[model samples]
Structures are given as C-alpha cells and as structure tokens.
Target: MSLGSRSSRRHHRALQHRAIALVVLASVLVACVFHNGASNGSPGSIPSDLEPGDVVHPSPIPGSTDQTIELARTKIKHIVFVIKENRTFDTLFGRFPGADGVTQGTTCDGKTVPLLRAPDRVGDQLHSFFDGITDINGGKMDCFAQGGYVQYLPQDIPHYWAYARRYTLADRFFSSIYGPTGIEHLWTFASQSDHFIDHERPGQFGSASREFCDDPLETALAFRSMARQEQERIYQAEDEGAQGLAQIRASLTSRWPCFDVKVLPDLLQQRGISWKDYRGENPFVQPLRMVRHVRFSSMYRNVVDVSEFMRDVKARKLPAVSWLTPSFKLSDHPPTSICAGENWFVTEMNGLMRSPYWSSTAVILTWDDFGGFYDHVPPPHVDLYGLGPRVPAIVISPWARSGFIDHDTMEFASVLRFIETIFDLPPLTSRDANTNDMLNAFDFTGRPRPPLLMRPRTCPAR
Candidate 1:
C-alpha cells in the first residue's frame, strides 16, 4: 500500500511541473516576439528600454545620428525657435523705407513690380462698420474688411530699416499652407495635413479650409519614422544591456518595475536635450488651439504659462529649443491691435538675445500665419497646400547675415528645414520633407552672426 500510494503521488507532481514549464515557455516566446519587433523599430508596442514616444529604427537619416549625438554632448546647442502670430509682409516690412518692394518697387527679370497690393479700397461695408458710422452686428464693430484696398504702413514710420537690417527678413516668404491659425501651426511641426478632411470644395477658405486639408507634405514625418527605427536599434542595444542588468539584479533583490523602467527624464538628463511646450498666456487665441491634431491627441503640453518661461529665464536655463507662444495679450489676433504685438515681441526677443544665452543660439523670429493682411506677392503654385496666399516671414539668427533680405518664396516647412540644417537633425513629415531649407540665411562657416540687435518694434495701429 505504501509503495503504490507513493508512486501515484510522484506521477501527479510530475504532471503539474510539466504544465508550469509549458506556461513559462509560452510567455518567453511572446516576449521574444515583442522584443524582436521593438528592435526593428515597429510602432505600437514599444520595448522596455525605450520611452513610449521614442522611435526606434535601424538606419537613420545619414547625418541625423551624428548630429543628435553631438547635441547630446554640448551646451553649445543650436536652435531657439521663437514663433509669433501673424502679420503680412506688406503690413510689417513693406513700408520700411529701405525695402526694395517699398521704394524701388519689387523687381523680377529686369522689371520692377509692386510687392503687394493695398487692400481693395476698404469697401463701404467695412469702413462703415469700423468707423462706428454704421450699425452692423449689433454695434459690436465687426470692422474687418473682407474686401478693400487694404491699409498700408504709413510711409513716415521709423525703424523699419533697422528691423530689416537686424534680421534676415524673407520678403517673399509664404505661409506653407492656407487656412486659420490651427492648421498653419501644425505645419510648423508635423508639416502634414493629416487632420484635414475637406479636399477640393471651393467655398471653404482660410483657417476652416486649411484645417480640413489633411495631407502629409513634409519630410519630417519620414524622419520621425526613421528616428523611431533608429531608436528601436538603440533599444535593441539597451534591451541586450537590460537583460545583462536584470540577470545581475535578479541575483540580488526581487525584480521590480524600477530596475526595468527606461525613464525619459533620466534619458534626457543623459542626452542633454531639454524640451517644453510653452503656450504663453492665452488659450482662446493660442496657436495650439488651432492645431486640429493636437486636440485629438495629448501631444501638446496645454499650459506653457509665462511664469514657466520667467522661471527658466531667471534660473538662466535656456534650453536647446525654446518654443514660446505669446499669451492672448501677445498673440496678434485682430481687434487686439498689431502694434502692441510687434512691440512686445521685439522687446521679448531683444531681451533674450541680450542675455548670456545668445552666444551659441540662433533665435528664429517668424509669424505663425499671415493675419489675413494683404500681401502683394502671390505664392508659388504648389499642389501641396494648393497655393496658399503669401505671408511675411523673417529669420533672425545670431548666425544670420545682418540686414539681409531673401527674395525666395518660403513656407512654414522652410522653418523646420532650417532647424534641421542648423541642428543637423532630420526633417519631419510631408511638405517639410521636401520644403526649402533656411540655410541660405546663415553661413555657419563664419563667425556667429555679427550682432544686429535692434530696438523693440511696433506695427502701425489699424
């Protein structure tokens, strides 16, 4: 009885052991598949050593890897992209007495031409509305002139030449795509109109039309994909490293999440890349609100309060990329007045450039979109955003040639491309991928651009 009972018990124990072994084997197989895919830089399920947003890829843009590594190495960082709200070229710089478009007339192929047309003589409807001479929209002053010989900068304005001289003004710059503040802001980053839904319907124009024009026309998206792949490759290395680490850790304390987590804060500390999404003060008119894709995702950091910027500045912490959007008071949405915005911006930038951070940084000053101000030069016909109207653009870098004017037509993608060139990072998606680069403004081979700092600016009151 003892021998028979003992044998039966041993058989039962053996079956249970086999079942446990099978379960462990299945788990290992699944983990291996995940690790392999993550190593290949596949999206969705990321690896242990990578951040959720991190992209892992094998081969990266040829120069991108080295550049990123170089950035990781230095405090002598590259771009400080400062983007402001809209103002048309004609409205802002055309009256600069020195602007060829203003005095000598913009020329092409040996012929002189006007850079922009004045708004159609403010239609009776608009002038009447603005003057409060007529009752419209319940006397709230719906003063916008949808048609007119728009107002031009008064010829007597001062400092127009100084602003141009101190900055790399792009007289022919164009908003990459059309529509309102939201769609154009996306162009600043992704350069893809993926969020746009409307295609060829004619009536939808401006911001509404653009928000609906979803298409990826930039190269940055491709790079993002590639960067993701490279990140995967790095994780593959890290995974291999983690396995070695885990085996070591397992031999000591019980395995916990802390030992396995690849924290972004830690990674950023190691890499020396600092990032923050500054939304300035106001939400109602903040460019971020207009970004359709952002609303659909948690991509944008909602509160980029001015207090944060002030705190960072006080701490003397100028990050590699300082993206600041002015608060509602600062954003150039109409009825708020344009002069106040320009004055505030010029003051803010002037102060920053004067700070110690100016030595190694290239501060980029640009308008987010043309504020529906009339620009004389028509944009080039491109199938991408489908010929958006012309907008003024300016690039002010410590490395930029002073008093320079670039007549080349530029788009928002051009800004990203400039960032890519200066920082040696790869481009993002869509039009940004194929768009013009801002390299023409600076000769990096030379001295950090000669100091061309100018006084705070203010556009004329409307």
Candidate 2:
C-alpha cells in the first residue's frame, strides 16, 4: 500500500482511540458519583440522605476506634448469639416480680381482660408489620385483643425464670422491626433489612420456604418505599386511620429477595476475624443465604449445620463470632411446644457451660418477634421500619452482672453494637451506630462468675 493510504488508516485508528478514552472517563465519573452518594458516611465522607430500600454502606464513627480497640483486648473473645423464634417479653415474663409487665390487657373497645394461661403449644397468631401497627393502636397498646392475650406461668418456664434470677434480664429490649422472622433475622446480621419488611410470599416455593436469594424459584420480597413512608406520615398528620395504613400497604413495591448490602460477616472477614453461622433445619430462618455475597462466595463455607456448633464447642473450636439458630421443633414458635424449646436451650447452655469456651464466650439469648402476643409496653418508635414489640433478652456470660435487671431500651441493633464494639469494627448502618453497646449488662472489671448449670425440666403432660 502507498504511504498516503497507510497514513489515512492511522488517522482513523487515532480517532477510535479518542472516542474510547472519552467513554472510559465518563464511566469512571459515574462510578465515583454512585460510590460517594451511596456510602453511608464512610471515612472522610458525609452521609447522603438515605433512600427507602437502599442498602446501607459502612460508616466509621469518629473517636470510637480507640475505645473499641481497648474493648477487643478484654477477656471476651467469643460471642455466641443464640436466636430463638417468636415469644414476647410479657408472654413469658409478665408476672415475674419487678419486671415491667402487666397481667391484664385493655381491648380496643375499652374493656380490660386478664391474660389467660398460654398453653404449652399455643396457636399461631398473625404478626405482620400491619398486625403490629394495629396492635400498637397508636401507642394506646390496647389492641392486642385482636391478637391473643396469653401469658406463661412461672411453672411453665421455670428454667427461663431461674435464668432471669441468676443473670441479667433486659426488660426493655425490642425486636428490630415490626415484621416477622425473616426480616428480624436480617436485622440480627446487618442491623438493616435493605428496606424489606416481611418474609417472602408464600406458596411460590412453599409456605415454609424462607429462602431469599439462593432459592431456585427466585421469589420476590416486599419492601417499604420512602415515598410511601413520607405519605404515611402525612396521612397520620391528617388523622387518616385504617384507610391510610391500607393505602401504604397497597403502595408497597417488591424486588427479588437477594440483596448486596454489607453485613457483620463482611467486616469480620475484612478484619480477619473468624465467624460462623450455625443454621437450623428450616431453610426460611437462614439470613445469610439471602445475602448474595455470603451465599455465592467462599464465605458460604462458614455457614454450617446446627449440630456443628455443639461439635465445635466440644472441640474448643468456637469462632470469634457465632450465630446459633434453633430447629423448627425447638424454635418456640406458636403451635410448637415451649417445653421442648426450653429443654433445647438448656441443653445448649449446659454444653457451653461445660466447655472451656464458656468463660470467654458471651451468649445473648433472645427471641425473634412477639408472635402476636400481648405486650403492654408500647415499643418506642425509632424510624420508618421499627422498634417492634418487646421481646425477652437474657445476657448470659461469666462477666454478665449477676441478678441484674437492666431496663435500658435496646433492640437487635444493640446486639450488633455490642459485637461491633468488642471486635473494633465500624458500624454497618446508623441503627447500630446510634444504639447503646450493652456494656451496662456486664462487669468486665470484676472476677468472672461461675457457670450456673441447670437441669432440663420435663414437659407437663398435655
């Protein structure tokens, strides 16, 4: 070819290269904007106004790094968070002395009804976000008549009551959200649910299927919209009642259950801290399975069966952070025998107490939701999502204050705060960032107390 023809081809190539460079620059600029906008106050960055259903990014609290580093040097090296299924604080400990519990409940129509004896296997009750709102009844707390007003006697849950007598019992702890199991589980790990409020829709995979991201069926989960929440506030201001709630519910949007949000494991992995999630039999209860990163990455290996927890404890191989969920039979969900649940809990405690990890481990025993049970105390409103009904929280650790009745207001985020503080990890969201770290429940300065192992009681014949 002639020199003139070669020069023409070279010019064309140069122009193509210039066009590609412009496109690359534009992509980089867009990415930077998205990162800065979505970062939840990352170091040296201001937080943007959070959108509804947006995944919260990490935010490091100024002046907290030093404090948390000192805490990580403490005797507690393991945190065993044992999460049980639904049962309200009042339902289990209402009549216990000195607790903020009531034996009677007021109906929506203004009649007072004494709490009935809850059966060993209570019937299932509706406890959706809507049900919680209706039961709260604009803070009057008298709408539980629509749900069930039942309480467990001391004889029924003697071991739990005994535990309260021996260890710190938090009377004011609430669920993270006003929804059911799946969302609450999400809060347990991430302190936020990516704005999803309820569980996956039933019947698509099966009524029992709680699988979110990893399910082959690819089910959609309902999430609240910030626009709808603002509208709800307006409706409340206008004194619109049931109709407004219905409108809000009708306006809800849905997305595939899978999410890309940051969770505690992300921080743990980054810091080289070991952790494990010992999941129960029911697939619906596993929260990490719904997180796309954990489910699909090498981190998935850390998700093990419930039995592995006991085995690990016996082998003295407990991780720095452990989450233990119960099987459906031992979940204490309504229609399941509470006796069996209690027995299972006691057995786990016994195993831990006998193991060497007990001294270094702080076990936080808590229920997931209220299960539509009557709780006289109205949950303090925190945000658009919740501070749902009160649930029982027992802090069982060698360093936990003995016989202490802690009334400090806390929720699932409080537990996250405790873990974050102990591990010197940054807060994943504003919820955990603002909540107290539960230092009030423990006395790390004093000598560690001896374990009080109790015998498993027999279930009464029904």
**Cα TM-score per model:** 0.55, 0.83
Q: Which pairs of residues clash in candidate 2, taking residues 3 or more apart in a chain or in different chains?
A: 210-284
Cα lDDT of model 2 by residue, 1-462, tens digit: 999999999999999899867754643342233222322112332223332233344443333455544753577899989898788998999998867788989887899998999989998888777667777765567776454799999999998998888889988888987768777898999988886767576322236566667565655456455564464452342122233466656646767788878899999999999999998797667788888998999999999989898899888888999999988888898788999899998998999999998888888999998888899876655555666889999999988888898777678888888898888788887777766677778877778878889888878676
Q: What lDDT would each prediction earn against the true structure? A: 0.45, 0.76
Tell me the spans in candidate 2 whose CA falls farther than 4 Å from its real position: 1-72, 145-147, 202-208, 224-243
Clashes of 1: 45
lDDT by residue (tens digit), candidate 1, 63-115: 33444445423424646555665555665666654442432232222344433
Candidate 2, 169: how far from true, in Å? 0.3
Worst 10 residues of 2 by lDDT: 34-43
Alpha carbon lDDT at 150, candidate 1: 43
